[model samples]
Target: MPELGLDTLKAALPEYAKDTKLNLGSVLGNGQLPEQQLWGTALACAIAAGNATVTAELAAEATDRLKPEVVRAAKAAASIMAMNNVYYRAKHLIGDPEYQSLPAGLRMTVIGRPGVDKVDFELWCLAVSAVNGCGTCLESHEKTLREAGVPRGTVHDALRIAAVVTAAATTLSAEQALG
Candidate 1:
């Protein structure tokens, strides 16, 4: 197989997905975040978007730009948030006070000891949560980030990356399915 990256993905997009291609370029070029946070958010959101091609490309790019531990943490954020988003979203939507009192019982030790910085991991999780549409998780992560002194603009940039990555993945998947 040929190498897949952002350029390859962009080129593969159909005419109707032009907005996604443009947004992908703009969001990835955002300067509000440090390299680690920006790329980590991109990689985590790619995994959360559930496209093998996008994930592979972003993972390769992230590996080239981020340290090994940072890459691992980004993946962990994606994996853990996948479960958390579903569970927490359901719990919040159910509106059962009992569920709130009960323990999550999930093994999420990674959130505490993610090899990367806590705030960066939280940001990545926030990005994934945004893609997953878990408002509870988004609010929780955003609050944590804000408390940690992360600027709103930085958080917004991460969400923008997540939004564009998810859109690109969905567009690609739709095109592949229709073809």
Candidate 2:
């Protein structure tokens, strides 16, 4: 299989710094998360970050390893988290008991029929939630993954991918703006 290289994206960054390269290497390696989960989570977080370069790079790397359904699940997770993170974070930050009691009323049918393994989709959601900084979604997805017997190491590695991808996206975006 081909390697996941951030060659082009790195070129857009400031001198292709060591830390970003190392983090990419660590997450892209065959680590705790299965290859599919690693790539899927990376893609979802990339989408959440909304960096075209990173998103395209991750999508290209993920295309072969991930089944179409899995890719869809990743996209779905990012989309849903984009909406949910805003709502839930507001609720949490506002500290309004009434808001907590109110229904979200958002259609999240994709969560039930994600077109991929439910646990895998949940993992993607968890990763995106991490990037979005949604405490509520993070707790819910983490609980679901744990109940489904997902190892903490796997979860940690997925979060690592999310963190690295997010940082890379931010770096690339700043480079684009500055250039």
Candidate 3:
């Protein structure tokens, strides 16, 4: 059986990345997140939160037409970030490459996403990074968004959303506490 590819996605998206030169998740995840950023973020969050069951289930639920770019991005981000963690851990424990900043640029912003208002994406990525405890990734995402003129308030708002979602598990506790 042939696997999924960009041309086989559920939806039609801009053929090219708008401002950004990459849609890393698309390439790495083999063209998963076609153009659905929201979907991709959710899936990515599930993966980052260490819920493999949910991640797999969600990915499976993504049908040919409803498949979102977010889901694919999440998978790709999780996969690459996991590899990155291993490299850093090994280096910290033994010997890391001197120029550690030299990643394969796997997480570079997605193509066709450059023109989309990216404040939300930045925030979402930040949340995922926080959950994964990836300072470098967090910094990179934040810096790029800020440089692109994402206002401070906008960035803060995005982070706030991330915070809320990141603490989604605490909702029950919060509700009980209020009661």
What are the lDDT figures for the candidates, one per model?
Answer: 0.90, 0.84, 0.47
Q: Candidate 2 residues 63-163, lDDT tens each?
A: 86788878888999899989989999889999878898899999989888888888889999999999999999999999999999998987888888888
**Model 1 worst lDDT run, 10 consecutive residues:** 1-10
- Candidate 2 — worst ten consecutive residues by lDDT sum? 2-11
Ranking 1 against 2 by lDDT, winner: 1
TM-score, cand. 1: 0.95
Alpha-carbon shift of residue 88 in model 2 (angstroms) = 0.9
Sort every candidate by lDDT, greatest first: 1, 2, 3
**lDDT of prediction 2:** 0.84
Query: Between prediction 2 and prediction 3, which has the larger TM-score?
Result: 2
Which predicted model would earn the best TM-score? Answer: 1
lDDT of 1 by residue, 1-179 (tens): 76456777777778988998888877785446889999899999999999887888888888989999899899999999999999999999999889998899999999999988999999999999999999999999999999999999989999899989999889878877888
Backbone steric clashes in candidate 1, count? 0
Q: Estimate each model's TM-score.
A: 0.95, 0.92, 0.45
* Residue-level lDDT tens digits of model 3 in 21-115: 13323332333323354444545554665533334433554434343544454565555555554454444455456646565554544522533
